[model samples]
Target chain A: MTTLCCGGCSWPIPVESWNREEGVRCPVCGEKIVALVFPAIARARSGAQPEGLVSETEASCFYHPGSRAVVPCDECGRFLCSLCEIEIDGRRLCPKCFENSLASNRLEAAETQRTMYDTIALALATFPLLLFWPAIIGAPAALYTVVRRWRAPLSILPRTRIRFYLAALFAAAELAGAGFILRAILRLPRVQ
Target chain B: MAKNKSIYRKLTPRRRGIGGFSQLWLASDHILLVRSSRFVEQYRRFALADIQAIVVTPLADHTPWQLAALGASIVWTLVFLVVDSTAGKIFFGATGAIAIGFSMADIALGRRCRCYLHTAVTRELLTPVSRLRSARAFLERIRPAIEAAQGTLSFDQIAAIAPAVTATPADAPPEVPQAPGYLPEALFGLFLVNAVFVLLMQRFPNELDNVLPTTFFGEFVILIFALARRGVRDPRRLVYALMVIALLFMSWDAVGLARSFTHYMGSVMEQSRRGRPAPPSLTGWVAFEHAPAVLAAGWRMVAGVAGLVAAWFERPVKTA
Candidate 1:
């Protein structure tokens, strides 16, 4: 069962993976995290807590302060609010952890791979040129495109990796064909 | 993306290489295994599943048999059929079998396969201090029985020697792994091979009732050793009878050309190899016959190295 969201990585965790009796771990950072098993009834109550009835922390975000908590990361047992929320593969995340995951990912991945958005944009800009050339620049560029596509892990999710390669192929081909025509008129051998 | 990080924080009350004495600690629900003192109040192995974490400590690498089993096992199924719990039982119970550990198998190889199964096994292990003592006692108790079992075809010994001839795939199994390392890996190999055969025979195109020869025999042998050691527990003659039954079952295959083709292939490879071919007298030895046993014996020591390598290069496949 999807037990709760982790306070650190903000990923959904199964009950078996967690320890409510003792602090469990943040699956991402491998840090000890308290798993507060809040009662459903208390969670259902949505008004300002009575003074002295709840401590300041009880009212504040368990993971982050200065930000009121509307909910907690189900896995790590950290409190979170809308601002701190991030969604990954259908799970919610705190802003800090979400950014951390992204940052860590960036650090983990080499500079060759930018961001998902960048890859997609690069692929998009390069598409539409495939028709112009089939060899020379086009052939080489298309090969790069395919390699890039292959490098990006393929999945059901809309991963732009494949598209980027295709786009590169198209762009390279278009540029090559255009250059071929210019070369032919400009007293240069046409590159096949 | 937002995984629970707490799982990775510390060891539970039990360390990864927990030996025999650690059993009481690990088996008991009250006991927790943590990695470090700083993590005492934080997270423990008990909650490892919550964060999809794996518990690995140094001494645990001493438990290498399963790791080698994993690498050798890739020839067939994507999932290494054998898991830690079953592998543990075999290693702890058996006298000296060890195998490789594939972190890929532990963590679902490439990464996409993060089902609940992975963490369950990696989460806890009884301590070695307890294990080594139990091992000594077990050997002494079973010495006579094991010696007897060692007679005849001596399945365990033959199994150990098989990889020497098996010709590991492109990533061939390492050469003559150090002691304790090879045993677990082979057992793990058996586990993985067992899992694969189960999938192939049961989950694939066949009917569920069809029992796999590998699992059927592997389990029976385990029982035989157990019963032989006990002698007085349950009737062990039944196990002996089952051995005959298994011998026949393992030999049951297609007739004529199909059998001849397989037999010939085995014979062709058997000649002039590092390992002696399965004895012609032994009718039941198939190619996969020693898959598990050999793998268990070969990689147990280096399973840690395999795991670390896997961790470095392994990208989990994202399963929907």
Candidate 2:
């Protein structure tokens, strides 16, 4: 199923030989296969570095990668890749830090779940209401969700800030709409 | 295979809604599994396992369209209650608006998500291949609840724990009957119809605008209400979801409004001391230029959504 691509045409080299891990070799170009899905992907077939592509070796884990782990610890944010990874409490941790961190607390997961639930609930609420009453209520709910997640200790932030972004944007729209309505209603002349 | 914790962090996050907003990711397992926006946003690792099912039901099941319509009705109802001039016309306009918005919502429901759900769930069912009957039976196990939500189980006499009401998004409208939806060109047909409808209903002549308190075209958006409940194959859940969103938005608006009034009053008193009479309303104190159109649009969206939810109760269910 795999075919090496040609460097000159950028098409797959004939289906006789292709490796996604190694990338396609260009028969006409005589360069290392760097066309589509090829080997030596770290270095181009021409052996030139592309502008944005970075070699995996050069990229350092925020923590120590030499400690023999593939994954970063979920708590301390250490770069403990697969082999060095371990379970601490219920979450994944680096082997060296797992038992030690286990003694600290288990509040992280519960708090993360709580905030996530609140945010999804509120974002869903914000969209339907931004036209209804969002100008007033949307901002506060969005803010509360943001503050709850952002203010938490770095060790335990909700893994994502997506809800806050969604809620905040829609809440702003809702509030603006409400303001517009209030303005229009009051401007009409009274019967007396 | 051990779970790769590092895979969670060393990740690039992006979203694509190729078909009705379902997201997918390049997982470490080298497969693209469809995911929830919230879940993908939260856990960097795409947990392909969580997807239980994917069903490609057409416009027959969406829910947001109804909520949008409901939003419109509520807005008009408030306006009629306050404006005090054209009661019958306003009521007629508002009720019609509610209906159209909800119907649109219903149509939008089956537009996309059912297919996504069916695809995702069936993929899981196929991993073992032998689990097809089990999977179908499992879904059937929840069939009554799903049917009750969809309002398909009439003879069972068992009612949904949730009562049917206006525009609750969780109520599962009955499934769209199985029809082969292949007309690759049908999308073009829909686009043409949509353009004509918008022109005829929404962008009518000013004479049309003059006759109605609001433009007749204003009623067109009610279509969105039916779209929101597509995920709910049952009536109860659809209603419950709609109720939650509608109530949440209304209460939120009510409280904020009271505060804005006070803010307006304080600004007025400050302006009045210079010998000008205070206007009875905030229009003078605040801005009125774009309020009505904006408010109407917002209402229209919510009303359409709410109506779609309400209409799910009227859907026909399969008798299996």
Candidate 3:
């Protein structure tokens, strides 16, 4: 049986509550919840059925010897049956190649995380001024970070290099201020 | 970076939470939920073809925050009227205006809500689409993408596919015992105790120095426990609301304490520079610092009473 659970409380909403333009109150949590069911829910899922090779002349699958090959893997060019063919991002790949692409982050659809180095550089440049002493260390560190990660891939979403520019400016100013302080300290009379 | 340009479009505005900020992005074949906490950004993608349903539940949760803001505005306005100094008057008046502004903005924005996306294997809450209007707009915006992937089903078709059936008595599951409300009760009890401690401090200023801090510490610990527990199981709305208010008040108190310490340290340095005796203990100085202590105490007392009353009326539910 197909079940649609209430969002508020994980209780399975009765079929009576389905397809209502106006929402129905969840019996368990009493929260008014509206469900927009799609045709996919009603559609039956079909699994792949690989046919056995009729003759020895037929091309056999790399993984399954008895199964006839339908297509070649996009990455490694290995013969694959319908069951072994995995399609993602307009590319048909075998199971091993698909897993490899995901592990290497070559497939954008499979990427699950990205480090935002620009935000880190900006934070390093600015957040240390609160204590007023760590800027001496933070300034060079921020500059180094920006220089090292300037060409690094940013968020998958569109973002500009404004943060990197801002960090560089702040780091330069901090370094200049530190230089002045160092000069002043050196110029001061030594007390024995 | 060039490879990903124009590949994903933003579907919703970024929403900030205690853990991080999250935003939704619409990809060609899937929708992505990106959560950025400091330097790292995590992503969860749901394919358009696999989505079974999108459920939206309108939440009346904003009332607590609105009430809190209104209460804060009144308290600050009262402080503004009672204070004689011009600086105090200006600060209190500005704070009052800001609080009222927040309350008005919250009302004008519309109702708050939560949107959940369901698939065959996973059910996930869409965090960025928390407002009712945004949730609707989000549904509308993604409808085309979903339709392109999975053809639409008419109401008649859906009804025919999932025919209505009256539930039989034998099909019903047995009633399960309700979980104990010890965490919320403890949290509310600590709020009451903290309010009493504040009142006692007003009476015998120096007597309960260590006791007040201990109570505050204990309250924070219990509040954290309640918040973490609520994540696993459903709790009463009032209890969650009270916990949020308590967290906000505690954060404000911590900032006030920090400011007081800085001011006290500056005063000590100035006095020592002039060859004069330093001031008294930091705890004593903080206790006497200019803040809305009485207002905070009153709010704590009110919240504690409300929470206890709500907990008293909590009804149990049976699981299927």
Candidate 4:
């Protein structure tokens, strides 16, 4: 069983202080805290144990030879005992397949972070305009980034491609500005 | 992405901070905290069934901003009254009105707070529900969804079950050594000193050359030290955040000063090349540059006082 702790000081909150509507002051930090105790807090977790084969005719688990197989792993289609089967996102997978899916980022539910290339492209296109000189390099870099990462998987959250469009527009303008500067320099009078 | 869009509903308003924007989203079985810094999106999910508590601690930090705004308004109004020129009077009066408006708006928003969500595995701060009023509303809104997922336990049932589970001595958290508190105190003290220097510079513009550089240098050095000393588990997180904001403000001030100096120097050089008499010194020219310096000083003083109060409250309780 796990005990509830004060968020402020991480001190064990007294049982009497739990589920108070008005809240209670943490004895350690003197900060007011409200604890919502759910039924799950009291519910004990039961660990799955592999069942032993009653007879030699019973199919044995792929990982555990002595244990009776309960189900097949969704990914690898190997027989797994109850103890070896891991359920994640409604799919029961073997330990090896679970590790593989997590490592390869094949499971969407397992993803914790993503690099937002659109934001990077937008930042590059806009922020460099402050210095003016960096725009020469920033513009091309931003353009390259947009083109390269165009097909890349976007944020898990719904996001628009407006950033890419804006980046391309700004980069084009910067390149035009640079070209204009070059043309102006070409048109300048030569020194004797 | 489309599947996620359909499944996850926005649970809280996006709160923008120096690091990035953070927002809460409700999934079928979990609540997700998404922190998106421009180039990266980080996710933290807490399953509804596992959530043990949602604690909201009242904060008085918002008062400092209100006080600072009110103080600035009063100062600007006084300047408006004193200035003889119509343009000066109008500008100062408008600035005063804007400051007063900001103070009023802040007051109307209700008391500020920090909300913390507790699960079996982790405790996370929910930044979106940062006001006491909003925290209550947010709790009420999410209660049904949470109840549906985990089922409800009455107060009596919770009280009955708590002692049996919590009585074990092994559940007690190990005593950890407290982090040193001097860094925040020193940083806040420096903020007050720097504020005083800014006010003094405004009062005696002729001394700006000596005072400004010293103040800026000392500020950066102390700020860097304070930031470096910050530990991951340090309880004075709000103070560190304030220090970061102050650093950003100071950096902006430095950039503004450099730009002004560059422009002044360029003008002086142009005058010299044209064989005309040079303009007055930079100090004399910028003597009446009142707004930014005054506002900076006002906010710094407010932050200094507020940070000191917070630090005092956060000091470890001694036991016999």
Better of 1 and 4 by TM-score: 4
lDDT of each: 0.36, 0.38, 0.80, 0.79
Residue A168 lDDT in candidate 2 = 63
Question: What's the lDDT for residue B174 in model 1?
Answer: 34
Candidate 4 Cα errors over 4 Å, as ranges: A8-11, A25-32, A45-47, A189-192, B1-4, B60-65, B73-106, B165-320
DockQ, per model, reads 0.02, 0.02, 0.41, 0.32
Q: Model 1 over residues B1-320: C-alpha lDDT tens digits?
A: 22222212111223243221121112111123323221121112332112222221111222243444555444223323432366654544342222223334343322111112122124233232123233333223322332232222233533443343322223223333222122222333444444455345322423321344445456446534543343222222332343334334333422222454466556756663757655443333233324432332233223324433433343233344
Q: Which candidate is the best by TM-score?
A: 3
Identify the leading candidate in terms of lDDT.
Answer: 3
The deviation in Å at residue B249 for candidate 3 is 23
Candidate 3 lDDT score at position B240: 83
Candidate 3, position B117, lDDT: 87
With candidate 2 superimposed using the best TM-score fit, by how many Å does residue A111's alpha carbon deviate from the native? 11
Q: Compute the TM-score of each model's chain A versus the native chain A and list the values.
A: 0.31, 0.34, 0.87, 0.87
Cα displacement (angstroms), candidate 3, residue B275, comes to 19
- Against the true structure, what is each candidate's TM-score? 0.21, 0.23, 0.71, 0.66
DockQ of 1: 0.02
Off by over 4 Å in 1: A1-35, A38-44, A48-170, A177-192, B1-248, B251-259, B262-320
* DockQ class, candidate 2: incorrect
State what share of the real interface contacts each candidate retains.
0.00, 0.00, 0.62, 0.52
| lDDT per residue as tens, model 4, B1-320 | 23324467888788788889988888888888889987999888888887867767766445765776688688877788867789999999998888888787678878877787876666688988877787887888777888998888887887677557554334545566665658788878888987887788777778765567676788789887777656544666667777878878887777767666766777788888999988665553452257878876887898798888877877666665
Per-residue lDDT of model 2, residues B1-320, tens digit only = 22213222211123244422222223323223323444222212212222322221112322554566566665655555545458665786677677667666444433331112221113221111112233233333333333333333221221221122122323334545543221212222332333333233334433232322232222222212222323334333443444445445444443544455557777787779887888764343321113433443354355445545453454444467
